[model samples]
Target: MSHKPTTVAELGEFTVLIDVRSPAEFALDHIPGAINCPVLDDEERRVVGTTYVQVSAFEARKIGGAMVARNIARHLDEQFRDKPRDWRPLVYCWRGGMRSGSFVNWLRLVGWDAQQLKGGYKAWRAHVIEQIAQRAPALDLRVLCGPTGSAKTRVLQALAAQGEQVLDLEDLAAHRGSVLGAVPGRPQPSQKAFETQLAHRLAALDPARRVWVEAESRRIGRITVPEPLLQRLRESPVVEIAAPPDARLAYLLRDYAWLGDDRPALADKLDGLRELLPRDVLAQWREWALAGALAPLFEALMARHYDPLYARSQGRHLAGLPNAHRVASDDLSDAGIQSLAGHIASLP
Candidate 1:
């Protein structure tokens, strides 16, 4: 008998996972580590769908089948040629319908252990959503609250190194959770992809142990935190890290100095602040950016813009913050951050 379709729980048993959806569909969201091996290119999938609606299902199937066969053959020749006979691959399409079924059937015919994902990508997506909802509420979350440049993220890393559970949400979102938080040359993941990544991390965590996370606004760059997880974060016990203005300014200069290299990009980002700051202040900041005087510019931004904004936002949103365990450091050096992490980890 031929192998049957497998459940999502069995995903780990397979050595290779293939997603046979069109490029556009796969780009929107996919299972982590699954390779795209589309049975239909984006244009061809569109053409087949149009033909099915306007012309005839029979005609569409005929054209689509031929295209799928050619594409699969090409994939086998170029991508899968060296696969060992014992290789086990799991395949899925949009709904585990024709696309993945056809691919699995062919792979099995060639004497490979191939299985289809029972409900395909849609099933996996539903699983992700369900897992996040179920697991987030059960986490022993500890929110790390601080003003900008307090080195909260660095502290989270230090905690992780010390074997404490930490969820770096900003890293998952590919952003630093600020107006200028974007990492150069690294675009943020799609919102769906971000959630999938978050869900995976949440699943790996031990719910009974405390999980450290940085405090963030609802949105990070283009991605929004899922409500279930965000709710837990908001209500968690808080650890507030405080530092002197000079210490924070120095840290900001070291951490974000790369922004000074691209004066045009830095100036463009500064434009977003015009409505909030005085016109003269905004112009001066821009002038400093263009002139590459980053240290003074950073100091001014910390004192004037970020510090005041952080105070207001913390008071308004983080009601639990007032009762937080406070850790004050005048130095944000590696030793200081690690020491802070040690103190946080020792918290009950």
Candidate 2:
């Protein structure tokens, strides 16, 4: 029946992590495996907030307390009804304030070993950032280098499937790290959420082992890779996937077939590169996109944009890229990618 707050480092598999923030707050970011059981839902929180600001403090507490009590009761009945007496759940709120403390108090009264998270979600976020800063420098990160359309992600997936340790940043970021990198329909998570997920993933791996990751700049879409981790990635040795231009083009055409179905969206994405390319050049790309000339457009982008960008970036930033151990292949098919992965995995 102790009410001590548990530190983030003290987290274990046996204890459940419950987030008692509003649904909107939880949506922005929470602990990696936390379940949302908000003490005050979105509207209730807003109403209580407005009351606190405009009405008397006593009035807001009276209103919020009643709402919190009712919500806590609902959760106890619907969510925690079947829990065993010994079940330990770590509960948190925005800043480990009254909301989570109230819920933890209720659960403790129920004779369960429920504890409040020390400093709540904010503390957890700080811990994640610190962990990355401390951990990234010591890891043996192996970068998989390739230009755009090189299918580095797919090959990295193959390498992962072959039982290699991989850190798939693009998958975590929900982006391909390009102007047109957004996955259709699936939106990216907030930057905090992305970093939390990355830190959690990194925590699970043995940093002593060689961790395979795709080469990327510090930024991916709207999300930026944590600077400490990005520094390690930039400094890592590279294993280049030297696929021919034709193979890369063919692979991109198949992989990005959806872009062909939505020409308007494709054209808009092209417009993002306006500052880099001339207006006339962009106009031609727009024309190519609208006419569904996606293949030629893909080639034009690779030749005029992605390839040159990769060349400069690698030469300037990637210390291990020039002497990268090359795995040359003319095949960009799934099986071919698998073969490339196997070869890379077998490297000393």
Model 2: per-residue Cα lDDT over 253-320, one tens digit each: 98998999989889999989999999999999999999999999999999999999988888888889
Which sections of candidate 1 miss by over 4 Å? 53-56
TM-score of each: 0.94, 0.96
- What is the TM-score of candidate 2? 0.96
- For model 2, the local distance difference test gives 0.90
TM-score of 1: 0.94
Q: Please, what are the lDDT tens digits per residue for candidate 1 over residues 263-293?
A: 9889889898888999999999999989989
The C-alpha lDDT values of all candidates are 0.91, 0.90
Task: Give the clash total for candidate 2.
Answer: 0
**Local lDDT at 7 for model 2:** 87
